[model samples]
Target: MNYYECMQESINYIENKIYEEIDLNEAADRAFMSLSNYYRLFFAIVGCNVKEYIRLRRIHLAAQELLSNDCSILDTAVKYGFTSADSFSRAFKKATGLLPSIFRKQDRQYMFERVDIMEKYFEIQDLELSEKYPDIKVLKETAPFYGAAFRAESKTPENDAFIGLKAWFDKNEIGNIMPDYRVYGYDIPNSAKDDGTYGYEVVVTIPDDFQVRGEGVVKKHFEGGLYAVTETTVGEIVKAWQRFISWLDISRYEMGAHQCLEEHEVESGFLNRNFEEPENIRINLYMPVVKRNQTEYGKVIVDPVRVAYYREYGSDSEQTAHNVWKVMLNWAEKNKLDCSKCKIYMYNHGFAKVKDFWFEIMITLDFAFQDNLIKEKIFKGGKYLTYDTSLSQLVSSWMKVNQYVSANKIASGNHQWVEVWKLNNWRFPEKGIMIMYPLV
Candidate 1:
């Protein structure tokens, strides 16, 4: 059997033996590889060692049972592969940093399943062969967005700035006026020399008549223009931004130089709402789009050579990931890489095994490519595709790519292909999966 087939067999073995004691030697034999070689290959290819992977899988299965079954912690632990509650607790704590009891107390509302499933199938595609361009119509009329925003230095999305904005809105009762205010991010034009730091604005829109006491603050108009808007519901607000960046990469329309905006359309009425309901909250990301143009509005930049996928444990996990991204960005800057050109993308998968949850974050770095030779080298094994998708059909568009690659029996190579997140701005989130193919 081929290496890919062996990998698939290994995954199947793990899934089947999750409720029982897993034997690595037996599994390796089943896959026709020596135990040592299997362990090495698994770690090298899957980013996790064999025993750790099995434990994670078991924990993942246990979590599902804890949510779906009526068994107690000890019983549940035994039903899975845990030796005892103590062993389970230690393992669980190591994986998720939360005790089983505490996790249970918070209830089963903590899982993000859809995002994980979407991510798993979206990253593999043969874009170079199936280049179907999107039929984008430049929006003649602009849509309306209402939210509260303020100016703050671009750090992480979970910086004190957001908390400060929330506090300011709550203090001034501005949220009462708009009722559903969201924090919107805008990139400042012609501010590249300042590391793109001076060029970003973190603002939210409110009603035109909303009162403000801050100096140098004004109600900016959202010019009605064409926008490519898509809606996604995320367990954390930060992942919403990651989803937006991923969509931008896969979409056909090139980003325009107009202001981008986000609208928080709260389904819960304007008062006393449950904060845990993922369905009641909807985030709409609007990116200005125009037909492909010769005059490039901005260049894409990537820096800081390291990349990893992270999964946030809960509501605060998003902020935690954001802060980590900021630190990485700062490190990249200190290393002489441009920060403004770098984008920290977050990919949220609703069905991957992360800790005891199904959410994982994929982070990538994009570097500046001045010479055509360098750009070609960077995208050396990258695949290109033109996707034809409507606003509502966006998720399915990615699935199409996955299906295409699987059907063609293409093998994933050593390195992932660089995906151009935005045709205009060169933006990519610090999370999510990207597919790359061999260049002819």
Candidate 2:
């Protein structure tokens, strides 16, 4: 069998005997390698030693059982291959920062999963460089980025924290887009001179209309504006980054209030031991900027849309919107219909923390979709009193706009009052909501 296939078989064997005393001899035998070779290979591709991995996996599984099942501490400990409760407690605390008893009482937002070491071995395609130089581009109202986040404690290149993220993505089948999707490395350094020793998040961008389901996952928008950009070949990333910083220093533009962005391409050459030739890798660095002579967000005139809508009632508008979109998308997928070209929208009708609120989520479908469950309506458009608002002040903002309309004696139209969402998450303080009051 090929090395990749051997690795897959080894992973399977480890998983099957996760709760048992996993023998190193048998694991190496599955990979068709000696014990030392197996250790080297595992550390290189999986990012951790085999024995450490086994312990980490056992602790992770134990966490799941403790959270979901009603078993005693000793029962859980012995069931997960631990000899004694004292040893299990110590190991669990070391693996995750939580004691088992305390972990059982809380609903953990995120958990680590088993790694699928196959991703690192796959064939990596080359990313063509347009040209190597100091380049700057102005991005206006770019789409929000959605992905998983994690903490990196140190600057050690061999740190295995990101392996869990890759494994989680693999388990969810979210890494299907290999070549097109770019993995981002976020580093908010205290001054750009810090040597990669900051808290980092390794994230993959979620595509539009794609479903994402996980905890600690968030949708964040990079403020649309001017940005200073630079590119570097894979092997000379450090030098390229330093040069980019120098370029920024000499540039006329000032830095905007956003974090640094790293776009990584060519997985084979990216900071891994599998491939050492840095010449094969390419990375794009983007830093948000404000022009010496600034700019502003321009006004947009939106036309009416005919949509099939779904309503979700709750206090949490963001969660309701997500749930409603899933229901609508699932319906479309179930009927074998294409929503690729369709525009999805959500309208917040109310937000009552103590009581139920209504959220009307909708999407425009072609005449081809004639489902009985979906109701259709046209959003009448005309001159509107447009104002930007957010989830926290949505109701208050609407009331103020209504008073303005009434005070001005502008007659109201018999159409649905529209609140177009500017950001994916309505909870975003800025650039979240655009309220449009229909006028006769």
Candidate 3:
């Protein structure tokens, strides 16, 4: 079988055995490939090892059951081929951080419940894309928007929330325009929800002086900007996100801090109407991008020991690290860290490989923190490193520094500090924290 056919077969096997046993050898046989080749190809195409992928899929399924049914943890675990509750807890914790009991408890709060549908839909679809946009002309215009929005979980394109949007527009006597009129959907994180409903704002643009009724909040603004927009039919939302990612990769354009907007086009008669057919709906996805800044000349080299300091803050639990970074930056500035000669970098832990997820934050200071204030902090035994590096090479240099520290078995004692001093525009005098090793 070809690669795509083999993959499809394996996927079918996984789906059928989801509530029972999974055999790697059986999957390989079904794919008509050797075990080694299956393992390698699976990882290459899926971005995850086969075993890990199986576990992720199982966890996703268990989460859905927890939300949709009244099954106990043990029952769900057993039904899904888990040997015991403890084993299931460990796997669940690794995938979502919350234990089964905690997840059950939060079900009423609708946290897990709201995401269940999205999770299921995500499992059955391939959202990644190789390209985002072909050559398209750019257009700029200001638009007016009016609509009522509430946060609710939706997996299918056809949902009550979307239907409600159409109803609201019709009730307010708003008409749609070609190409410009669309629905802006925003995803808000770190917020509380009731019955799986969180806070969401939706805006639908209208013509001049068209005011929406119903005491719902309304706003108007200019939407003119460099937007990388793409269109997809009703069933192609997943592909659209992939296209946006591809566009970003090829164009080297950085995303600004803003919520993306989606414009939906439906038949004119469908206003405040429910339709069962998918072909009647269309969607346009827009992502905003801005130009990147060019690097300045003269860079510094940071010591490996100090790079480790930033690495530790990449953890999910490092709350105080951001404050520490601010203090270090202030010290460097007061001490005459040379902006021209040095580089400054911030790293976040838990970056998403496929979707939007990231871990902790890491900061690397090059020559910019060399003044007297920084020296005082070092003399006081503050936990930081002073390195010499230009800003442009900070990420790669830090990776190398990490490699060196790991190879040499260098210890970062209790302080665990890394930072860079800004001096003359030249990269030099990189310092790393020294640690004592435990005696065997």
Best by TM-score: 3
What lDDT tens digits, residue by residue, belong to model 3 across residues 1-440?
22334555886786778777889899877866567656755654455677887787788878878888788999988877889999998998888878988887787322222112112211121123312233221222223234335333333323544555666666655542322344555433322222343333456655556544554445545334445556565566677666655455445343422345555543321343335665535455666544333211122332442321222222212234445455555544555655564444333321122122222223334432333323312211333323334433343234333333443455544532333334333323333222111111
What TM-score, computed on C-alpha atoms, does each candidate reach?
0.28, 0.32, 0.33
RMSD of 1: 24.4
User: Candidate 2 has what TM-score?
Assistant: 0.32
After aligning candidate 1 to the native by TM-score, how far in Å is the CA of 126 from where it should be?
Answer: 20
Tens digits of per-residue lDDT, candidate 2, 1-440, equal: 43334667898999999877888899988986657556755764577778888888888888888888898889989988888999999999888777888877876632667886435432221122113331433333233455554334345422333554565566666645422344566542221112433345666655655565555444443334444455555456677656654444444444454445666542442224243343545556666555443522223445776777777765443466677766776775675555445555556543222234456766666565566666778754566667665654455455445544543467876656667654332223335666777665
lDDT of each: 0.47, 0.58, 0.47
Off by over 4 Å in 3: 1-137, 140-158, 176-201, 207-223, 268-280, 294-440
* Model 2 global lDDT (CA atoms, 0 to 1): 0.58
Model 1: per-residue Cα lDDT over 332-426, one tens digit each: 44445443454333333322323321223233445432322111122222333333333222333344444344444555444343332221122
Can you rank all candidates by TM-score, best first? 3, 2, 1
Error of 2 at 370 (Å): 70
